[model samples]
Target: MATSELIYSVSELNREAKRLLASHFMTVRVEGEVSNFSAPSSGHWYFTLKDAQAQVRCAMFRGQQQRLGFRPGNGDRVIASAQVSLYEPRGDYQLVVEHLEQAGDGALRQAFEKLKTKLLNEGLFDESRKQPIPLIPRKIGVITSPSGAAIHDILTVLKRRFPVVPILIYPVAVQGESAKFEIQAALETANRRKDADVIILARGGGSLEDLWAFNEEIVARAIAGSHIPVISGIGHEVDFTIADFVADLRAPTPSAAAEHAVPNQAEWLGGFRFMENQLIEKLRRQLSQHRQRLNWLEKALQIQHPGERLQRNAQRLDELEQRLNKAMQLTLKQNQHRLTLGSQKLKQFQPIDKIAQHQQQLQYLQQRLQRAMDLKLVTLKRQQAGISQTLQAVSPLSTLERGYAIVQQHDTSKIVKAAADVALDTLIDTRLAKGRIVSQVKEIIRD
Candidate 1:
């Protein structure tokens, strides 16, 4: 008996089995229901594919999972394309999934995708269509179940931030089949009331099937058609629905929606205080400027007296007259000295021979003196005439003499310059050329 000494390691046996399965079933398609499907944190998916007879373990890497349009979950029927391979370490046979597609419910997913794409193409998710949430909403309308935590959170936030703001709650179903119509009706009611500044549509987190009401087309359309800005806070941070896309604003959580709807009271109070201070400061500055202007006006009025101005002018005129008189006296004295000197020189030049000549010169000088005096008198008289004419032009007495009587109110110092100033049946003082008369005005006439 020549038995061949044959030995093989476990790894070699498993490797040979894997190579045979990969070559034989390189691309085999199997239809089964997904069970325990889980995409681990390592970016690798582990699940079991089961049929009526048996079950098989499966692994789909991240690279292959990326190709899948939708995530597969438990109870999902899928057609998986994979290769039969053996794990070399454990020597266990498993299917390495390369591709997967929903088997029975693929049509529904396709319809959802189609509708989403159509709405997206129609610009339903456009940022420009979004409305800005009011920073300080005066009134907030809540559309949710009356007993839900969402309403509690919103009310608490609103009361804490701004207690004065009024909140109007329109309780509506947030789950189940009838929730959609209730939500739509609530939105319409809020719009009809026109009381709410902004509307908040909120609910707590739930499963996709539980939250199907928010994804309904009618609810989405209602949110889109609402005149008031709608904030969709339907589910958890990871959950999204049609309402989220159609709403004017989407909040990740119910608490976040409450925070977004109103401002903090402390912050608003701080800002208001700052503005009040600024207004007060501006008023103070204006008042100070007006006070300084009043002071300047008072000083100017004190220096603008007509009597004081006249007194200063009189003093200046007197000084000028005194200087003029002194100049005239000095000129007269010089002329007299020159005359005496000339007489003395004539007498010395001819003792008694020049007596006739000296007399003729004296006569000529006297005639010149007389002519100068006449010219000065004539100049003085002309000056006096000009002064008289100027005085007459401005004199009230001169005006009265020209048939225009000056009338003064008997009780007031003001003169009745116009007929309109004195009414009929009033006492008045009339000044004529000779004297003044107190009389009552009977009938005043104006031309």
Candidate 2:
């Protein structure tokens, strides 16, 4: 166990071989016949770089393909700048291409130059045909593969800068045999819908053959004919296509296309706030002016109508006079009632009324006194008659009427009750019932 050798698995051995080969041949220029060429949906190109002796598997990633100047055919001879490496998963030796160019006659390059010159002479790439990008687009239309990194980068940038803006995606193949037709059809669809304010034709960086769709005359004409503004963001900054020349605007990358499509939300918000403050200040000034005008109008109306003040004063005087008249009438009625009540009280203290009452009372008292005197006189007469009748019962004059005699001395007027009682007088008078007689005493007789 102390002197045991290090063991290696198949994967470890392949990884070690890849590392060693990559370090030894960082950069190499190889001449080969292009064969078994293919470009997958990932924007990576795979082909065979071959000579008469041997052939090597070659891979050109999307990023490194951007430096390719011309398209390579199956039998074309080319020089490819590449790195030697082992594909660990397959344990296969390969070359990773960074740049590719045609070798001897450069027919493809001459054709590219000829086409560019022809288009330039026809004014297809004139600056006058270019339109300006809108400051803020309502909707941004994108044409690219849905799964491509170009679309992802474009969407991420658009969301970060202005999330409120709407986006419409038109999925299409950005490469291969049908890529040109699909791109042209997408441009036509965008124009028919008229929904997007600006159209962006985008794809990640790639070689000339990988980006051949954008170079097609049909795609270039579609971009030129679009009513909506078109922005081209195809390969990297170092790469350019015919679509880039015909589009209204050209951006170096897909993310840059999105940046050019919309303004930053924060900057727009700041501008709106500033405009709001300015509008508020303008409104305030207008309101102040209106208030000043109103004040001036009110003062002018007051100064123009001096007679209105006199008319109001006259109306007030009339109202006060009516009130005074009503007050006087009410006071007169109250005083009349008081006077009537006082007159009734004064009648009770008047001397004339008191004398009249006293005269009636005195007349009543005199009538009562006269009646009492008459009653007293009649009562006294009745009492005197009764007394006369009682005295006559025993009176001598009454006895004379009854034939009884009363005797009296003539000189002394003495009456005799019996013969004995009357002594022999010198002369004795005797009175019969009707007459008196005088007799002398001749004898004293004893009964």
Candidate 3:
């Protein structure tokens, strides 16, 4: 191997290849001729699915052969639904067949798709509508053929996972023309009785025709309508059915369905033990804290005596009393000293003497103010005389007195300044300095 390169053992390599192939080609429906077919004592059927150009090994377990219509020999053409896988021991690639059909069974495949589309459009296969499967069911109801390997596998797996839960078998035919009716009735009956918390609808793998009962609308509707959540364990891992879509949960096989229905007992027990130990440890820690507190309280009570506390309180009261008395004496002394200083200062003020001095100053100021007022009055009177003379010089009355007459319209009192101010025969008013006269114009004049 190259340095630092990851390497795998033969078994690991084969397992990894098988997982890759299984995940890559989840379900394949292929047509090929059967060759080298063999059925062993172990109830398993082995064969080679081949075409002219290629071949692949195939296995159909006995559990899947109940409804296989005919045994396919070499040279027989067939169709199968299978998953690609590698057998680790032999390191050989092979196909694990889920269902086998004769050359012309493509019609069933088409019908399944058509029904799937119809239900999907109707919201019957909606994820929101699916009920939650109970992790720990009180009781589980199974709808399948009582004698089939599917029922046995489910019971065995349930015993291994969780055996406390009761299993109620609702015997019904898992194949044939009446299988759909039986399944529908079983589902309705399980719901009506309310005996089981969850329902498991299961059957073994077979030809497409044999498993068609699960693909029927009646069975699908019954599963969808059931009050109890339904878990469909139909055929092999590669098988797809209408019931699978309608059910709350779908498992590849009956054993897997049982595994999904409950949790592992060993794991749960281990978890419970761990939790119990943790709880005990926490309780111990709390008890230790409480014990420490109790011990501290006991020692504190011993160290602190009630009599000692009383003595300390008495001393504090005496100290406070002495301090209060000293504060009162100091306050009184301060007040007395302040009173003496205030009295001496009040005597020094001498309000009467100060008032007399202020009166004298006020009298002198009054005389000065009176003199100033007299001068201001004289100045104002002079100014008034000058303004009167100025007004007389430019006054209209003085101009009129100088022999100039003012003329105006008699009725309107409008002044006439020019010859055009009067119209012919219009009445006029003429005013001298002393009086006014009214006259009429006899002639028209223009200047």
Q: List the residue pairs that clash in candidate 1.
A: none
Q: Is candidate 1 or candidate 2 better by TM-score?
A: 1
Model 3 lDDT tens row, 171-203: 999898999999999999888899899998999
Ranking by lDDT: 3, 1, 2
Determine the C-alpha RMSD for candidate 2 after optimal superposition of all C-alphas.
51.2
What's the CA error at residue 16 for candidate 2, in Å?
54
> Which 10-residue span in candidate 2 carries the lowest summed lDDT?
304-313
Ranking by TM-score: 1, 3, 2
At residue 276, what lDDT does model 2 achieve? 100
Which runs in model 3 stand beyond 4 Å of their true positions? 1-103, 307-447
* Whole-structure CA lDDT of model 1: 0.83
Error of 3 at 67 (Å): 34
Structural similarity to truth (TM-score) of each candidate? 0.56, 0.45, 0.47
TM-score of 1: 0.56
**Least accurate stretch of 10 residues (summed lDDT) in model 3?**
305-314
Candidate 1 lDDT over residue span 286-373, tens digit each: 9999999999998886666444444555566567556756766676688689768977886678557777877788788768866776
Provide the clashing-pair count of each candidate structure: 0, 0, 0
> What Cα-based lDDT does every candidate model obtain?
0.83, 0.83, 0.85
lDDT of 2 by residue, 148-237 (tens): 999999999999999988999999999898999999999999999997999988999987778878888888889889999998899899
